[model samples]
Target chain A: MAQMKSANVRLEKLNKHYHRVVAVEDVSLAIEPGSMVALLGPSGCGKTTCLRMIAGLVQPSSGEIFINEQRVTRVPVHKRNIGMLFQNYALFPHMTVAENIAFGLDMRGVGKADAGKRVTGALDLVQLGKFSDRFPSQLSGGQQQRVALARALVIEPAMLLLDEPLGALDKGLRESMQVELRALQRRLGLTTVMVTHDQDEALTMADRIVVMRDGRLEQVGGATEIYQKPASRFVATFLGASNLFSGKIETRDGAGALVAVAEGFGLLVDGLSNEAREATVSVRPEAIVVEPLGNGAPRTEVPNSVVATIDQVVYRGFINHYYLKLPGGSEIIAYQQNRTSEGASSFAPGDKVIARWDASSNHVLPNG
Target chain B: MSGRLEGVGAWVLYCVTAAMMIFILAPLLVVMSVSVSDSYFVTFPPQGFTLSWYAKVLQDRDFLDALQLSAVLAFSTTMGSLLLGVPAAFALVRGSFLGQSFLKSLVLSPLVFPALVTGLALLQLLSSFGSGDARLNLLIGHIVVTAPYVVRTVVSSLQLMDINLEEAARTLGASRMKTFWRVTLPQIAPGVAAGSLFAFMVSFDNYPISMWLANSEYSPVPLVLMRQLVNVFDPSVPAMSTIIILLAVVGVLILERLVGLRRAVAI
Candidate 1:
């Protein structure tokens, strides 16, 4: 009924070890108030472990967690005043919808009269007011998750933690709920943290994405920034498909660095330091343009142009993917949009094609 | 042609199932009919229907006393088994400790060990301790055998229960004790109900253990029924059996009303 005071959460050098196995290692992060941050990674990469540590469900081996600038690392789960939605949407099977929502209020010592009104309000908030008397088994999966959400929010927690909230839903429902949940979190301005292995989900819903790998933070930034300017080869591949070229830096000047690939082939990357002697550059599939070389195609005077033969053609509804093989026996992929109903017909297998991109599109990553 | 043969095979299976059901029920049917027989001796085809044997058994003081003692013993054994078995189930299912498997085997060993041997061993142990009360001795023996049923059913129920439910309650501001009361107990109620039913019935109809621990002053119904069957040649034995069967049926019906018979027994 009142405005929620969204709190800033901070984790300092969090480490969790189960016996000799490290689950999370020296991870530090500061979440801004009123912004949703998604922990995105593969399974067993410590994203869920990070979320659990913040929820006080899993105690960090050596770390300090602060909520609203108050130390809560040693606090018990119930006293943390945080709401968490599990992946399974753990609704009490014995309690009705209203009873499930009212459980938290009852534990907080809310009186019966007030609790009744709040329970009704929470049900209406999730658009399930009529289903309050029904058991959880009678509701669909989407309805059950909504009831779980309503139960978590009725406590008016300072922060909301979601662990793969839409993982159990069907594809169509998951997409729709993603939009709806993001809108609700924005309206409430609740500082939220969610864990998911779905890259599309993290890209679509989060204000900031924290990519993790091997129990460590890989990259953390806005979705577009991390997607475009990935810091490593793992990020470049994991976020989306990329064509990588490993080379030796031949020239370094005020303009940029020139990387030499195979004999008589070179690539120029913009806005990179001259100190590195070798590097691996990545270019996204959608950024590369493919054209037949003998069709009088006007080519730009860029060092990124390469002659390659089409190895295979994949026809999607709105786009077509061309897998091409270079003279050095390396493979590169390019995506072209289908402007007509027949899809892209400009490239086919065994066709000699020239794939190219601008110097600015190349992202130089460290040679590791 | 194959479809016709398959239909014939299904008919054969159905007939065999029906025959098995009748075979299992025939003994009880004969006893029930003899209990209501108006003849002087127990007969397969009763001449006429009468409730006189039931009336006779109800009026007998020794039969009444044995009935009271059996009911008390069965009721006390159910409570005692629950008190000892539910917590053991929890510890074995949820706790992590050394020799956990060994402890589990120890708790459930009575189910596999012969009940007659358990009774004899208990008799020797109790007499060695200088405790000569027949009621206490019989109670201890009954609990030892019956507790395994409670432990088994409750353990299976605990294993099947979702652990996330408890964690969700804890996150929802419920303490550990409160979470158990509000979440865990309700989910496992059918198993506990089934276990109590088994405990009551086993302790009520027990014979071998009672043979060792029971005295003339504290005799159970099974011993009394055995003595009556050996000495008499009348319908009263069948009548006593009919009463016990009716009590068991009533107990199951009450459990069904409390928490769905299908659910209670499905565990």
Candidate 2:
């Protein structure tokens, strides 16, 4: 078998327009060689359009695409030598797993003898070596997906592209396939660009995620960076639920800034000292810790604290979600683990409580 | 009581279906019986059965010529419509252009138009173009009438198919022609088969169009059979009809085996 040469894919100012509608704006991205990058966005956000452009399935109205430092913008899809897995698997129903996998080899003029060996290798990699003779309709959804994956990888293309690769599977199967697909891509060290609307799948499977919104890039980073230090308000809300507080910066200091929020409340944002006079800050629900007023002094040194009335305690399976109404009429949520019965029983509705979180948990955004 | 009622309802349904099948097949059975009758004249309770009429019909050189002409015309018409209609259907279904729906309706209008009117209109149009070869005119008329079935079947088949398979093939390094030939063609094959079968049967059994278009030199079996029916009553007419009916039955059986009867009926 020939060694697969992983490619570094780059799109420079790529733009796609369907008449007056802009499907993808001027997007420039450089994906590292042998890395699995994800284009994550909601539907119609142009993540798919970008992926299709890279695959040469959709032509860009302007700009260029490069794989392994060679311009391939004008190249036809078949000549691009890229592998793609469709959302529906698109496995040939009339063909067996071995025949589907051998399709790429036959196209490249590989002899029947050599193609047979490669097909077996690909099926084995997907852990379906014994199912090669079975037709696509004979297999389960996950099994069919594995065959699609085997078919794409058997060609040993320069880069792999997936358009919502696991979107068709049910929840349980989707999660397991995410893990398996990530492991396989890493093993092969093939640069892959997967487009998906599922954020958790992107975070779990991608080395770096590029988030898009309305044909524009929102934020590009790892999971924690986008979660803890979101570059924009959309990123913070889109990736996960965040309680946003709009305020104006009143003072600046070494540690942080004092921002005056609603109801004359000033928040001490640990890292927003000198950024701007007007800003927005975000705090995750899990970051806020709730304490009953009469429970005594706090053990943890949390500087930012707010007194509020307990509105609701939702007893979920693993946590008691505390919904607190603050003095400023804004609602804040705190999640307490259900590990101890003592903590679960400590809070009740309308009880006076203090919600405290570390000042470092405040993630300040520039505007909007 | 409910189970017994259900059984009775199922039995009633079976009886009704059986009656319907008999209703459809009775006329063909009558023709077959008359063709075998030993009597010189046609009668209902076909007198002592014999194979003489069939032999006489087969031996008639003019009848043979008409049957051969109809067979060639039907074959040519099937091939012509398939060649023309499949690509037109593909363009209509896949292409995004203005006036597409109007174009499709125009192509499929022959099915909705009255066959007599269509036949007269086609004869006028062909003659006005100054092409006087009666057989060629008949061929063209049959193609125009049969092409709609080909288009309809192909379009329906293409719709049911997974179009992403074509993209999958292209991404696998197969060129556009190869992708269509290897992937798209096989996926919609049932539709093509069904369409050609429909075209052949419609052309072979055609009377309304053939009557107006065929000349004496190029008379088809149906035209010849009609003339024979009008001139004099004979069991030989029934014999020739039986042969044609059998041919139609065999065509239907082949179609059912190639593309399931359920699919053909659904279309």
Candidate 3:
């Protein structure tokens, strides 16, 4: 059944300008059939603007939107046949749960008997079958969110749009709903686009993540590519914790290049272009290894190693983070997983430590 | 010493509030007392208890005509204000347009304008437009005086509503009109009912506007009562005043039941 109704969307050079401010600029993306894509960014980063344009609530300044190869940029919002779950759920306060879910089918001119069956099925899918007669105010927050999801799905729209769907939920509920919503989407093979500022939500649910910044696209890739190989400094910082080292290229070696840091440290990195004069290198915090100075260990020594003092230590449940101050006053963060057998780190604040990473772990970024 | 001062302040506040209540209710109470008087002349104190004055006032043809005219005018004003004011409130609150602040002030400005001035202006404008009938002029005057209350009340309710509800409706395949009728209208129904009631009462009890616009033969109930108070010393005058007071009280109670009294007044 899912294979019979696959959904595809193609946005072509979409631009939305509100008076003097350009809300979304030249954004073009193709969402594959039966996959979830997330537009991840901070507030005022144009993620919501892009979603609104796709929902046909905001007209683009210049672009064409195609849903299943049909241009729908000029279509009226109601006539577009799309479903959206608002951040606040937006269930009709006066209507019961069943009536809210039946609203779309009724608007589409479906018969009462058929609409009732679909409403029941939709409610059952969301596990709210018995609460169909309750008003929105009578339900819990989580139940209301599910009813909103059910209402959107009952229409079986060509594509589903969720705008910060879990923003109003508590932390634990948000995490659980992320898993539940992802499973539902996969089970139904519904094409979905979600707008969220949370990196964890994007990584956990979306098959592809489009990171936006300042009303423009920063990078669009799978979770691993976006995290492991960020195209820019903003993407690297926005997606996760990364230690950025500013350096100038000194020379080129076989399959690597040498760089000179400001703090009297020379390092070699892999995958650096020969013509690159200066670069900002990003290394993930978890990729760095911290040890006591002068501890003899054999590892790949092609990259940077900094002698630094541990400034602060934050212990999360499964990991410990160390903030290290390098010789040149630059700060770097390193994360170490807590193993059951290994005790906690002996290094305290103000203790000298050697922070090291392999050359291949660093990705050279263009300075902006 | 501080505690003693607080007690003294509380007593003073209670006295002031009681005085205000008596000041506001004095006229209505006097009219009620005079309506049951057995004396033939209208006065503050009754000579004796009787209902014959009420019966006499109720049967008078001129008084009935004035009462019917006031009712018709009040009903028409309420309907007209709702039709005009609700949409104006929606536009002022929800729409993003240039001069929105200016437009809002313009809609509510009639509240601050003197009723006599508005009545005179409407009378002049209507005569220029070839409307010489007293009822038409009075209807126009009442609409002008009452529209601001409707606009203000509806706008207050519109501000409290969640705008995302309308967006959600649109996303669910509801057209703009359907979204309004199904979602926006229900949320603001209390305000709409309260505003119309206020419009009706203001038009019904208005004197300054009716005096300037009404012809001698077609005066509203309030204007007629005022004329009787000036011209005659009959007990029927108080009886008629008592009836008018009761009608106003009923209108207020109905509004309070529809929407809370506190909200209607605050809005």
Candidate 4:
């Protein structure tokens, strides 16, 4: 591993339009050096387009890009000195693993002897030293991905861009490789930007997550911050399952505001002003506590408590999901982790239950 | 009853395949045998299997000159077609512009047009300009017919290639020329080789085109072979045919060794 200069990348209002269709619109962000940030979004959400623009594969329609404070908006892709791993890995089928890894060095006009040594070092870095003689077709999918990773890193690039790096692998391999890739990226101290639609991969690997939707940034924050306090309904639903409640604000308060959903149905929300007339709040499924309402135990009145009937109960291996229907005929899901067999809640469909959460758990999405 | 019909269908398929193979190979086998025959005249079941005709054909001054001329013409035509066809294929497969499809059809129309008519047209077109170079005219005519094969094969190869490989090379610091040499060329070498082999073989044995384009001073092997066949009915003619056939077989085998024949001809 050679010492790499981690670059600070900044996109200044990057916009890409293919005729009338806007691929990416007004995307501006600054990426810190040696940190992994994920552009998380669904397909056709312009995450891949943004990454390609950064890689210089796609030119931005009307914006500038800077790498390490130097403008590169018009720089050609080959001269950018960036390492990119495509979704398909893009290993040259005609070249052996060693030769594939040596391609970048060869392009840079590195001497053959030195290139061979570095290729060996890169192979060992990815733990594929023994398979250097094999072609890409002979390697397994995971092995091919590792070869691609090694090839990208061998160039000692300024930054690394990954487009769905683990999307090709099976579930088990994908999880393991996510951890492995993150560790390798950290060890190299290379600034990396990865584009992935899978939220779990973003959460597990990236230090920051930029949630994108419809060519715009929905939210940008740390994984836990974005998950717990999403800025928009799109972020709340896109990242994970969230129970949403939309209503009109009824009262103003210094600490919290109350939102009225139906007649006599007021939901207390914490940390909000009465500036907006309408508001939408989200609560995580696991954050809500579900208890049997009509049992010998009396139900305690809570700030965000709502008496609902369980519409369905789904038993996932490690957790149980309760789909509850509130009095206003809106459906909400609550997840209860099955820690132990004796402590697992045994609620079935049509069972009367009280679904409640603290005021702090109810996050008001400002622009929802 | 359906099972029996399927069995009969399978038998019919096998019979048809065998008949087709024999139909294709029978004349070739007969010519090969007659080339080695001991008789003065061309005879099949090849009298005593002598190699005298092969030696005698090799000694003929007219055949030697014709062989040299055809060899040079075929080699030059292969090179010319490759030079023109490869870039044309790249343009056809990768470029996007108005009338692209129309241009594609126009480039490939030579394959469907009768070569004899093409030769006649080229003769008229070249003569109208008073282009007196017979060999160059013949070369141009042969290239018009053979370049389409090169373009077609290379186009199929380019189409089947994964585009991401080139992108990866670019991201790996390869310039456009470097990427083409290191990634694109190697990937499509099989198709290029196959196309060149086709051009060489087609140009070497071209009769209809050569019949219109060739003169006494610049006659190619096919014309000389045809003239020999008409003037003298001997094993020497079959011997010369065997040599051409052997050259074609050797070319195919060399191509197969360089890149698998299955891949080369897969298009």
On DockQ, the leading prediction is: 4
Docking tier of model 2: it is medium
Candidate 2 segments exceeding 4 Å error = A1-3, A270-275, A295-303, A340-345, B1-19, B260-267
Tens-digit lDDT string for candidate 1 (B170-221): 8889988898899888888988998999999999999999999999999999
Candidate 3 lDDT by residue in tens digits, B139-210: 888998898999999999899888988888898899999999988987788889879988998999898898
TM-score of each: 0.93, 0.93, 0.94, 0.94
Q: For candidate 2, lDDT tens digit of each residue in A125-185? A: 8999999888788899899989999899999999999999999999999999999899888
For all the models shown, what interface RMSD does each have?
3.4, 4.4, 5.0, 3.6
Encode model 2's per-residue lDDT on B32-133: one tens digit a residue. Answer: 999999887899879998999888988999899999999999999999999998899989997879999999889999999988899999889988999899
**Candidates ranked by TM-score:** 4, 3, 2, 1
- True C-alpha contacts between chains kept, each model in order: 0.62, 0.73, 0.68, 0.86
Pairs with steric clashes in candidate 4: none
Regarding TM-score, does 2 or 3 come out ahead? Answer: 3
After superposition, the stretches of candidate 1 with alpha carbons farther than 4 Å from their true spots are A262-264, A270-275, A295-302, A340-343, B1-6, B261-267
Q: Per-residue CA lDDT of candidate 1, range A168-199, in tens?
A: 99999999999999988998899999999999
Give one digit per residue, the lDDT tens place, for model 4 in A202-308. 99999999999889888889999999999998899998999988888877687577887652356788666546777888989999899878656534334578889
Q: Each candidate: how many clashes?
A: 0, 0, 0, 0
Poorest stretch of ten by lDDT in candidate 3 chain A: A294-303
Docking category of candidate 4: medium
* All DockQ scores: 0.45, 0.51, 0.49, 0.56
Each candidate's lDDT (Cα)?
0.90, 0.87, 0.88, 0.90
TM-score of chain A of each: 0.96, 0.93, 0.95, 0.96
Candidate 4, residue B18: how far the Cα is off, in Å: 1.8
